[model samples]
Target chain A: MKVTESDDVISFAGGLPNPISFPIEALKASANHAITENGSRLFQYSSTQGYAPLREYIAAKYQRVHGLDIHADDVFITTGSQQALELLGKVLIDKGDGIVIEEPGYLGAIQAFTLSEPTFYGVTLENDGLNLEELEHALQQPNVKFVYTVPNFQNPTGLTYSKEKRQQICEIMAKYDDVALIEDDPYGELRFQGEPLPYIGAGKLENSILLGSFSKTVTPGMRLGFIITKNKELMQHIETAKQATDLHTNIFSQYVIYDYLANNDYMEHVQKIIALYKNQADAMLNAMEEFFPAHVDYTRPEGGMFIWATMNNGASAVDVFHKAMDQNVAFVPGDPFYTSKTGVNTMRLNYTNATPEVIREGIKRLGSIL
Target chain B: MKVTESDDVISFAGGLPNPISFPIEALKASANHAITENGSRLFQYSSTQGYAPLREYIAAKYQRVHGLDIHADDVFITTGSQQALELLGKVLIDKGDGIVIEEPGYLGAIQAFTLSEPTFYGVTLENDGLNLEELEHALQQPNVKFVYTVPNFQNPTGLTYSKEKRQQICEIMAKYDDVALIEDDPYGELRFQGEPLPYIGAGKLENSILLGSFSKTVTPGMRLGFIITKNKELMQHIETAKQATDLHTNIFSQYVIYDYLANNDYMEHVQKIIALYKNQADAMLNAMEEFFPAHVDYTRPEGGMFIWATMNNGASAVDVFHKAMDQNVAFVPGDPFYTSKTGVNTMRLNYTNATPEVIREGIKRLGSIL
Candidate 1:
């Protein structure tokens, strides 16, 4: 019996944050306050650069956290970090321009860059970070415009770059003056344990572009994300692209989000989400340990939404996925995550969207299938 | 002293809707209700196609209004109609691909299409519509992907197509089997006096793509706009482009907007807006008639945001703008509106943002400069 998109299925397919962690009450209050305080301004078309107060707040927060000399003008808000990817492609990529990505990368970035008709070079993503030798080789290629990475708690793999590796990678890329390092850190704040890793290239490299989003920490539905860079000329080009794309990000959402940040303890709210995800990750990891066959391997993620499982016994993930669906369980096959489409025996399990018990049940079913 | 960015300037330079017309209280109520009813679902990442209910409502409304058969799947919501333009460009345009646009077009559309690096063919927009012969000639050119038009009260020009011209243009366009017709009607609902015109190509042509927006009637800040089309293959390609551009439009805004429409009398609210714009439109035209020099010819717009003024005396609008700025008055010099940048003697004056008295005063100051 094949179960497809049933309510009874314990699914780990969605790359969504736990909705239970969303600050609903605070957001509701913020929405009302934003409307009341700003009035018509909240409903009016704002600048292409984004809402002023929100941009300033983002700049200040980054400065405080990273101890970087970041300015408000450097923080450019987007519809989501997804849009930042699209806009970056518009700015940087011409037909057949070289773009470097991790072997198994965030598919969203892959999809966004594909529209620009770039030749993608996939550098292998090791346990700590990118394989530096491979990255340098890719960077050495002609017209290599940028290297995209989700360094901290990366999507699908749930991997973070080690501090030493981060430093080493930045040094390796420092030779490539024209190349940009895009450090997309959507899951940086959701660290369940360990010290937060510094971005590899941001402060050191002139062409470093950092992306952050409120999707994981605050809410995804509002679609508020931003790009931070000190490169004025690059930012100006991006601003022009952004204007052409959608005029600007939604102004009302910007005001409401800024208001929510102003009124609430944002870190406190993020802490609650971290706690929830930590529990779910533990449950899934423990379930895999208890039930999976000896040949199967999976990452024990410290933070972030996904735990990547690799079938070591020459079993295809797509086949396993079909069998798992028969047992009322689901997960994303890992093929889509690969630019080269060679992750045939791997699957990505999202731990954030499900409760601990439900995650355990889903993993048990998948383990039985395997 | 020149007025550069002072609050005292009585400006007719903004292409913004009257904030007085924004259903603020209803929106606030709907926002609250949408949150309370939907809970976490409203805050989660939604479908790439957009919220299903809102799409359905839009399709139903178009079907009712236009007497056309439109399914819910035909309507795809965007961040703004601006995004629709961008997405259309992304799907249709390759480097040096032929694209047809108005001679004096909406700057936003021009900006959006420019990113795709298309070879723009600007057909002359006559008093009623595009010159049929010019349009036919342009469409005959190789690889002409689409002809874009704002048929009802066009941006920068404030001119609507005559009924006969609408049909004639469609008939001429019918000769080109591969070319699409994009009928952008952001201001169709804002008709203060004249009868609402039928879309030239929509429902009549297989490749007709209609763009609409809530920005003019509802609120621009929410950034809600949509593309309606009967062409499944074209829409699917656009959906792919849209997914790459931004994962989705703000889902919270979509739910809030849908809820607002569901709970409130949307047409009644629109009627109030129409009435308000009518007053503002009349005020600006009356002021223009009373104050403008004989050599300055301007469109007496029946509806929509702008009044296009042309200087028959060969004085640059930019020069006039500079002089008007010294008098603490402003309007957009129309050079940016043209693809070839030849609207030197034309200016676009927006009446919607300013009050009637301010409009009168600004026009009087502009008249003195003339």
Candidate 2:
């Protein structure tokens, strides 16, 4: 058995954001401010409802940026968007309930919902987003509780739903009264191309719950995220579920982020990160175009860290992953991302952490191995 | 219909440690050092396995302080002791599986386990600890997956098990090979009286999992805790569960606590808190004895925040609570702590937050209402 190399290898297996993107100097100032201004409250066990000021900021952001009229009461701060998914799974998913997911969606979502032993229904992904027809068919099945979608630049696929598809999906969701929709948009702010589309939850859709994160746009290590919903019944259930989880997200992290947002230009900071990742993505895609086999196809992502690639001629992604690792480049085999047992010849390559030069070099090495 | 006040009352309701006890200066320094020295790593997504240095420190403390031969591999850092309980509930309990809990235990544990829909068997509590006869009877029930206990200074009751009871409980657990034990000891280090006893997990009890927390001793708002178990299978399952729940505990908080532990005198700091709480507890107890009716009875705890008080003649604690709140004093009624539907004529008071003078005044006001 071959032992895996340490950090010496250039790898795309990690879903980490660029370290340079973190506002460390600003955070230090915020930390000092928090200590000086509200040290006692920062250390205290805060309400399970989360910090009021932070919630207000988040609520205002949704309204001003996305044009969604969310009140502070509708927002629940979580340890991460991951925790929001878990809480939803706990509250909404009865044992053996069916949950729809994109064919190659996030493994974290799958893991979060799997604890409830929910039957997963996979909707095939097109260039735009989830296949609407497949999703409608899945919702027709008995016990289908909710549809989990990353409408923005998705985790592994890095695919965003087109405006037409987003509207159609929302329309289809409106027709189904029983099934709720979980719109997990962690990477929404990372878009590097075209105008931002309205969120699936932007319209007066009571059944849709939106999950947004500071992880991608701000700092992943802070573990701050939130859920927005208009359905009072569902929000109450999720809030209870959140209480049972970690009581609430860390008060200090929430306060620091609140302070940071209050003082800095969040959009500008996110744009800086988007610029960094865009350069890396361009380098990787250009290298892939130059060196990859003619039969291979990959998504031209608009934004986010990952680029989904599919090899031709029935080549296993796991096999490709092993070969790529040997070449000092690593990517997560896309099989785990799919709910179905049948493996696809696909993998996810993350470009955020790598420099432009490293991305080019790593992709070239991987191409040679392929 | 009368409108109830928002649940945001000055809660003696939560089992929170004194906010004053948090070493804000040390934490600020640690946070500064973590960001300044290791900003990139601190801000980056960390291993799901947890921060290595923090795990090593916790493991070392277990060995040095308790003479327990536990390795770092045996420890898993969690978002909080709350998440540890949540993970255990997810991995261990199946629907309809029986779990043994104290008659009046931590509400957080109850809420965490409720998601699994396990049939809870409540064991009666004794002055020292859990009633052994009741515990044995509960353990005899078929499909009892585990017995959850807080052996050292329990949450609501502030009771610690005697050395003999600990040995007997371990022997019984050994006798029943199928049954597992979850010993949550968040308040073990806060002992103000008697010498510290070995944890039940220390006696080569492979069937037990011990949970330790930095919350009560250091800072609850940091939300740092760990689970130690000898069972590798259970630990692995929990790690998977944790990955789904929140990916991992916040990396920055983990690093901050690790750095603080490395550079600061944690023991001395905790001792100061213990001394402060002991004085507060003494003041509260003295006030209660002087002011309360002769028929009212309460426990005099050696450590931890709570004092479980029972009213005579089935008097409603909720009524007393309302009256006390009207007099500007508040406490959590004990009924919600029980797994059973039957309400107990009792309430729990926390002495940790209030100063000696405040505690005495609060108790006097509460006594006047009763």
Candidate 3:
């Protein structure tokens, strides 16, 4: 009873995939298969590092997808990528320690790291990538823990960094020996138009910690994700942190996901997601271009669930949010995404959940209200 | 790859339910039913408070089982009771904070809170319950965050507090306005022969935080657990901490558990488990009575998975543990369970994981070694 609680509300605030994209048939089959074949083990306690085959598969996928050499030992399966952030916060952040994040960042990351009592420095984001100058300055801050970024089709904003910026950011992070770099890429496989850019992890930055999730391409219900890094010391700390947190992620989930991945062409399945989200994203963008107020500008995202819209002349998104709720149309207000007193006039509109017609209707209502 | 990693290793180290006790058939049916009927919602992201019906059910169960008046709003579903400990640590413990624990306490709880850098004060536990004077002294310590205890057939020791002791402990904790009380009852429902003692929360301790788990009754694979509290402020902090941790537990697991609970007589199933474990525990106790050396004292537990065994005259359990492992019989060493330098001659043996024949052979071997 959270984001999907109301049926009357045309909600575009969710950061997950449409339920129709869920591989229900395959999952059902996998459930039966796992229960029949590995019920005793699947339904029992598992290691903190996760199911061996699944971890190996994830490691292999990284090699294939990002051209990054990673071992199974370097990966630990989490309940979700959010848990990874929380574990990283536990392992890395100290009270009053500085943590670098993107301005208008993922709110979940903000919530996760804040629990550890870290001081945050949010680097401004250009259309193409992060502001390198601000990132450098933030990295140079005393006791800076890590630079957190969603480098591929970032949440809320749905912006992917250029290849040049990706490499440059990696270099900038590498120059700072103390700070680790978290390259969160939940939407990496959702790209529609451009060639897939190299992950910052591919730059071979030893401190580059890459996080990936199946929430967008697969089902969020499973809540499966992974944290991969070459740093064994950091990984060991994270593993201990994870064990301290949940013992381990649900073993049944790891088994089900593994069964599904092994029995199906996961890449082909992700391709279908890319196609569907590409259409939905295009529809939302097209409607926004046609119906949005002249002063309101939004990103033209190639992939991911959301479009970041900023209303010029200081029009508050929270005000619009309240008004839109009355109209039975909802979008997430952007203030929570900002660590500072910024993004007051910005909002995140998710395009992945609603159809083209619904997107158009919602945009029309908002335009008239504005 | 934890306790059950090797088939050759007859490990009594695990604190989970036997896999054979898992309702695999019912779970498979529930899985299929959930996928077919509620896949869209089940697989989608849900609330941090948990699935509404499940929370209501948990609150109802507490009323039925422990005679506690609780609301659905007072319950937050955790990944396992382990995550509850982790969240508690994050909310309550800070670097150098004082926390009271039982001597030879739950190792998992120690691991969870140690991440928060708390200075632990372990009070010695007697047969019936904790030594009240020591507990009172520990509670009076400056900066004490909370007192953590598993009062119902506790892990490793398998010691359940008497109802009067539970009440007194609650009153003692209530007097300490600076600290809270965590009553972890993962094995409360497993009592086959003992009288149903009132929970510490039933004493109306204002600061009491109760944790319960479904892992033992249903299956550990799902990793479903809950944190119940009447204190809304503390509950809010735990919810925020949980949201930062894993967003929420696996949704499908919640749906399946809910479905199973609603459709079946969950109590009857648990009763079946009670019978099975009671037999196993009795067999192990009988074997120990017949085969154990005179100086090797052990608790005659009426319930729970473990029996507290202490070898007299300073016999090192660490040495016994290594020898036991060499003989292909494994148990958790007692050192990790203690917060202080004590319990040197102690070890814990689990009865839930072995059959009567196996228990007999294992005890015979251990007796010969002693």
Chain B, per-candidate TM-score: 0.98, 0.95, 0.96
**Top TM-score model:** 1
Whole-model lDDT values for every prediction: 0.90, 0.84, 0.85
Scored against the native two-chain complex, candidate 3 gets a DockQ of 0.83
Candidate 2 local lDDT, residue A103: 85
What is the C-alpha lDDT profile of model 3 across A263-354, one tens digit per residue? Answer: 99888988888888888888888888888878988898877778998889677888988888888888888888889875398888898888
Q: How would you encode candidate 2's per-residue C-alpha lDDT over B228-260 as one tens digit per residue?
A: 987889989988889888988889889888999
- The order by descending lDDT is 1, 3, 2
- TM-score of model 3 (CA atoms): 0.96
Error of 3 at A353 (Å): 1.4
Model 1 TM-score relative to the real fold? 0.98
The model with the greatest DockQ is: 1
Worst 10 residues of 3 chain A by lDDT: A1-10
TM-score of chain A of each: 0.98, 0.97, 0.97
Between the candidate structures 1 and 2, which one is better when assessed by TM-score? 1
Q: What are the per-residue Cα lDDT tens digits for candidate 2 across A1-370?
A: 0233366678887788888899988988888888789987887777787899998998998888878888999898889889899989988888899999988888999998998889999998788878988988999998999999998778888888898888888889888877888889888888888889987645556688899899987788889989888888988888788778887788888878888898999889988988888898899899999989887899888988899898886889888887877787878888889887556798888888788888888888988877
